[model samples]
Target: MSSENLDVSSELKSDSSFADRTKSVSIAEKTSVIAVEATSTGVEGRSHAAETSTDPLAQPNDELNKCVVVVNKESGTVCDLWDDHFEAELLERLKANGWEPGLKLVKGEEIEETVVAAKSRKIGGLIAGGGDGTTNSIARLMLGSDIPMGILPFGTLNLAARDLGSPLEPLDAVASLYPGRTREIDALELGDRLCLCMAILGVYPELLNKSEEFHGRNWWRKFTKLGSDFFKAFLSSPKMELSLGMDGTKAERVKSRMLIVVPGHFQDDFGIIPKRESLEGGKCTLLVSKHSSAWSLFRMIGNFLLGRSAQDPDLEVKSAATLSINALRRKKVLLAIDGELAKFKVPLKLDLKKRALLVLDPKASEE
Candidate 1:
């Protein structure tokens, strides 16, 4: 049978079981119960339960031994629905599959803590459950380590998960633990800081920096705000002079309204926008758009929606092994990496690390 047909059967069986489990409980209540039960069980009990659960995805495999799951509670509001019952269900699922699930809750500023916990426990694999920012945090901590990482989409954008074709359902995510495929994604290191997703300045970052309450009003409101923000940025025409390097080449000066370096493509309600080439083999992709005019920005948006970025001349795309950025002026620029906002500093260095991360991919062919 074809792979699609096989996957359909498997998906049906999996969905059936999930339905049975949650038939009597609302999604919110079930999640809450799972979290509470799992937490109360403590690490030892939870491990034991995972070892005995009947879920195929949780079944023990040589590849999944000593797996640790690190979660960021603030990743997405939807994750808030994940309570004790949901955790209990997950534990049961893992145990059924003969795997042990080690869960760790993380604080926003406690990236180091999560790393220490994973390392000290000799975890063979790490599961990052959060949004782009949380994924970035876990990836940063696990860099240089041999351990593989799993991406669990629990964010608004979920750019990485969409790119990887990972499972969206909770149990399916746990099942993906067995895929064992790894992709070497590019990362940008600004000075001592690292960014796994795109970094941006100009109108995009400003929209990101807005409070959730303001942007949460409605789709129309968000669109209006974005339009207004773009106009304001265009009127200001604020430009920053940057010294940049591509593929170990000598640094050159470029002035632009926005500079975006992305490790992978990002898709939204609009459509797919192709990103720079793969980051494998220790190379990073840089995209520079100098057009500050309102018309230029509108055309770029149209191009993105139409998936015609390759045909756009104003969009300069380059591949490099490393890039260094320095501000020519004293004024600080707004910076955002992986959707997190910050202030830009001069002399920022970004280099690609080859085969740095081992992430889970469900669509990968089985060995």
Candidate 2:
């Protein structure tokens, strides 16, 4: 199916968040204020009185008093951050704010079990200490539960955490969780997988698949495999028919080179990266590069640089509430969800779940 244009400006508005201007406030105030920001959309979906009404820390909220922090020790930056005494310092800081926070350092495979154990204890909140994948994994468990979550952002590219308004600094992020709010963010669903940021298809996934064949081989073998994979993917990338809507009415067929699907409210940095203004927005953007041409890649780059939406003949972008895809060849499609590669059976359906996650809200900064 061809990508159809949809309007999403109304869905891109910024929500209220804690402001950096109050940095000089007392430690208690810091806890209450950050919690106030987190619960900005209060129980009734209104502003919490804590913002300008009452002290959140003074309230007898058991959920806000106890917390668990999950660290992916294998993540690229976690070891470095932890070695610098980040955990001890944060624990001391949080304890001073009257929190009984616990820490759990786990390998990648142990993530699911750790989440279950934490939830079984009915912890007030969870703070993920890694990159997007780790954050996404933790979030999946917190869905439909009262357990709010926070992020430590130790990944190579913590896009999901950044989109949720988390700071890059470990100290600021930790301190901001003194009191946390439950935020419902839109999540993408494809089969059993949850995509927090974006889902990728086409040449990138093909290249990922090909490169894995030489993953443990020597450098020369990996380098040679990369080149070979690129040429093969460029020539052999499959054609697909994209169908939109739950009923599968809208359709377009393209000789796909690459396809990137992002939440309707993806973050915008005015850089080469794709921009979406709202995570709670119930919409998504489909960025498709047709014909698999090298020149189309350059055009995509230029469009991003110029802040122009993709509407050219070779490349186009569509924003919608949901979409579906089917391989014309009816074969397994290589897909990448939040940077992790996987294979999904075709005729895949994707839809958005609005405000499906809760996170510690980072305050707005003038900088």
Global fold similarity of model 2 (TM-score)? 0.71
Q: Indicate which candidate wins on TM-score.
A: 1
Give the per-residue lDDT digits (tens) of candidate 2, residues 1-367: 1112111121211111213222332221222112221222324421443335322222333455777777766554554445324545776666665566666666677778877877776456778877666777787777767777878877655677667666667677676665644567788877656788888887776576545422111335544565566666665655655543433565766656678888864343455444456778788888877646567655655656666645456766778777878767655677767756667666777878778777666542212
**Model 2 CA RMSD to the hidden true structure, in angstroms:** 13.0
Q: State in Å the error of residue 295, model 1.
A: 2.5
Clashes of each: 25, 12
* After superposition, candidate 1 runs with Cα above 4 Å error: 1-64, 95-98, 179-183, 210-228, 264-281, 365-367
How does each model score on TM-score?
0.74, 0.71
lDDT of each: 0.58, 0.61
Native RMSD of candidate 1 (Å)? 11.1
